[model samples]
Target: MTVNQQILLDNRPTGEAVESNFKLVQSPLPTLEDGQVLVRHHFLSLDPYMRGRMNESKSYAVPQPLGEVMLGGTVGEVVESRHPKYQAGDKVVGMGGWQEYSAVDANVPGALRKVDTTHVPLSYYLGAVGMPGVTAWYGLVKIINPKAGETVVISAATGAVGSAFVALAKARGCRVVGIAGGPEKCSYAVSELGFDACIDYREHTDVKTMAKALKDACPDGIDGYFENVGGYIFDAVLLRTNAFARIALCGMIAGYDGQPMPLANPALILVNRLKLEGFIVSEHMEVWADALTELGTLVATGKLRPRESISQGIASAPAAFLGLLKGKNFGKQLVKLI
Candidate 1:
């Protein structure tokens, strides 16, 4: 008999998330059903959006239930299988949550997908070639729809989703600018990621100052914006956007802990005739095949380079998630479970 280790959400967080909110336990594995496959997770992805799931408030997705396994994406191998669709030793990706093993039903839609790890690293399925990659593709190709010689700006530019957007937009001949927390991330964005310029948001104390700096960085004005960090960053981007610009509202990590943060310049949307659209990638399943095909090709061919900040064990996931919310993660944050 095998023992499965799991992390359960103990409590809903009030402000900042603490390790106490999650509880770890071990249990004996249950018998596999007729159409079920058993997976041993090797890697678990820790993304910023999981913060929203911790809350009880209404949002794009349903709030995570308490005392259940904390929700997450996982890449692992099938250890045992009773399902015809999957066999032992097959690599799969699914919503395996924070656990060492998952019993997945093969008949459910969007439950699991087989992956070939020969070309790209197995971990790439959790970040670059998975949800985040598709997120970048959806926002750019479907929303912003940039043309050659246009300027595209993204916040949290060195992160999994943002970095992918940088590579995608650059490939389309659009000049890209990034906004990051410190000088190091800014430097990484410009030097390693091929960004035209990067702004260190820490240098500016207020939105006005940051807007001034953003204007200087985007001299031609921002034609497309991919917003990750809201609040002042949105204000700064709005100040530099052109008349017919498009903005894809991906995330707003700053206010996820507490009350909603109001935009400093909401009127600019109407004044500039901007097309501002908020999207939830999970809700749009139609584009996954096309998005993954392009993203996987770019990563395999050396055109897209995504960085990772990996934690060594499943026990480190809570801290890694907290650090990501604080902007301490340098790139895609993951917890190695194997």
Candidate 2:
């Protein structure tokens, strides 16, 4: 019999999660039934949206119940298999939750995808080539809809998703300006990721100044704003959008800390005729394959690069997740169990 450690929801958090919000518990591995595979999780993906799950509120995704294992994406190896579709030693990517091991029915809804790690790291299945990459692709092409020579501004520019947007937009002949929290991230956004310019929001006094810096970097004006931070950055860019600008409203990390929703600048929306829209990645699963194919080509050809801030061990998943919301994570944050 095999036992494994799992992080369970200790209590629903009020605002920012503390370490006490979760607890480590030991549980016996489930018996492998027919058409099931017992997996030893190797990598766990910690994303900003997980923070919303820790609360007892409702959203597009179901809320995490107390005493249940925290929900997340995991990439792992099959230790034993009863299903013909998967065999022992197969690597997979799926919503394996925050458990050291999980028993997944091969026929289960949204069952894991088998991964080929012969050429890439197994963790990339959770980052650049996975959900985040899909998100960037959809937001850029479907939502923002950048035209050639247009200016696109993206927040969190060096992150897995953000860097993907930067590279993809540039490839389409759009000018890209990225906003990150620190000098290191800003430099990486410009020097390595090849952004037209980058603004270190941490050093700037206010969003207006940062927006002005972006304006200077993009003298023509912002045609598209890929918003990750909501409060000030949204307000700043809203004031500078050109006529018929598009806004892809993604994660709102700035307002996730229990802050009241920032006042809407509807007047600007009316004047600029801006199109602001939000999306949940689950809603766009139909296009996942297309996103994967396009991003995979970019990656294989050395056009796209992804950075990850990795923590060791499944136990570190909570801290890594907390760091993501706090802007401590440089890119996609993950925990490697192996």
Candidate 3:
């Protein structure tokens, strides 16, 4: 019998999740049935959406029930396989939850993607060449509809999705400015990530001041906005957007922690002719291969860079996840399994 370690939900988080909300436990693996593959996980993605699942409220997606393994995306190697499609030594990516080992049906719905990691790092498949990058691609291209020489602004600009937007927008000849939480991330966005300019929202005292800074960066009104942290940042960007501007509503990291919602900006929508569209990435998964192929090429050529904020062990996943919610991660956040 093989023992696998997994993080179980000890309790639902009230506001910010503490370490006590999760517990690591070991369990014996069951005999694998036909068409099943035993996977040993290597890396697990820690995303902002996981926080929503920790709650029991009705959401766009169903919440994970109490006492079940916490949900996550992972890259794993097929160590033991009764399935003909998978053999030993095949690397795969899937929605594998938080565990050192798991049994997955070979035909499990949305379960796996065979990976060839010889060129790009294996971890990159879970990040820039994977979901977050595709999310940015569809959000910016299909929803935001950025034009050449337009001014495009993105919040949480140094994060996985935001950084990807910076690269894609730049490729389209649009000027890009990033909004981040600190001087370091601001610098990272501009200097390292090749953004035209960056604003440190934490340095600004008020939304109006942030609006002024963003305006100063653009010198013209914003044409496209890829929204991630959408409270004060949304208000700030609203004040600066040009007529007929489109906003891709990617995430509202600002509202994820149960904070009081910021007042809406209906006046700007009326005056500026702004179009805000909310999107769920799963809606575009059918066309994911084309998006991933383009993103992977960019990563392979170094035109796109993915910063990984990796926690060393599965035991640290709770703390790492909390850090991501708090904007401590520099880029794509993940837990590296030993």
Candidate 4:
């Protein structure tokens, strides 16, 4: 028997989540029964959405129950298998929660997906070539449908989803502008991520200043917008949107800590005749195959190179996740379990 380290949601956050909210415990790995496979998690994904799930209130996802393994996406390898379809040493991606290992029932469809890491890194199956990339695809293709040469803008510009959005939009000949927290992120968004302009939102704190920066970055007015950070960025982007502009509302991370993030100028939506839609990527699973194919090709061809901010060891997960909530992580936030 092997010892497994696990992080469990110990208490629901009253406001902002803290490290104390989670409890770490070590336990013996369960013996694999028939139709079960044991995976040794290589990496655990830390996403903003998990913050919302931490609350006990009603929302899009079920409130993460207390005293359980924190829900998360993971990439790992099969160390032991009692199932016929899988063998030891198989690389796989799954919702294995926050733990060093998981005993998955291989019979459950979509519970574990075997991945080929010859061309693409296995960890990418949790980021660029996985849900984040698919999220960018859905928001850009299905909702914000921008034509070539149109101006597209996104908040959290250098994050996992934004990185994918920039590549897809650039390939389509759209001029992309990004809004990020600091000068470093802004520069990386423009110089590395290939954005037309990247606004450092820290410099423009209020809606007026932010909107002015948007005006300068997008002279043609924003035709499409992928919204992650709401409040100031959302209000600012709305002011700069062209007539018939489409906005894909992804994550309102500004209000994730239970803070109120009311739109300061929602009348602009009507004034500009803009279309806005909020989406949960998991709800749109049908287009994932096509999205992954394109993303993988971009990655394989050396077009879409995404960065990662990985924390070492499972013990770092709680602290790393808190940093991620504060815009501390660049690109995708992950914790290496091995």
Q: Write the per-residue lDDT of candidate 2 for residues 200-310, one digit (tens) a residue.
A: 888775766866876777788899988888877777788778999999988887766567766457699989998999998788889998988887778778888788899
Total clashing pairs in model 2: 0
What are the per-residue Cα lDDT tens digits for candidate 3 across 1-338?
A: 37888999889888877889898999897579998898889999999988888888887889888898998889989899998889999999988898888888888767877998977788888888888889989988898888899999998888889878888888899999988889999988888899999998888858888888987998988999998877877888888889999999888877776776665677888888889899999887776888888888888889998788999988889899989999999899999996
Q: In lDDT terms, how accurate is model 2?
A: 0.85
Q: TM-score, each model? A: 0.98, 0.97, 0.97, 0.98
> Ten consecutive residues with minimal summed lDDT in candidate 3?
257-266
Q: Name the lDDT value of residue 199 in candidate 3.
A: 91
- How does model 4 score by TM-score? 0.98
Worst 10-residue lDDT window for candidate 2 reads 255-264
Q: Rate the local accuracy (lDDT) of all candidates.
A: 0.91, 0.85, 0.87, 0.93
Model 1 TM: 0.98
State the lDDT of candidate 4 residue by residue for 136-212, as single tens digits: 99999999998999999999989999999999999899999988889999889888889899999889999899999
Ranking by lDDT: 4, 1, 3, 2
**Candidate 1 residue pairs that clash:** none
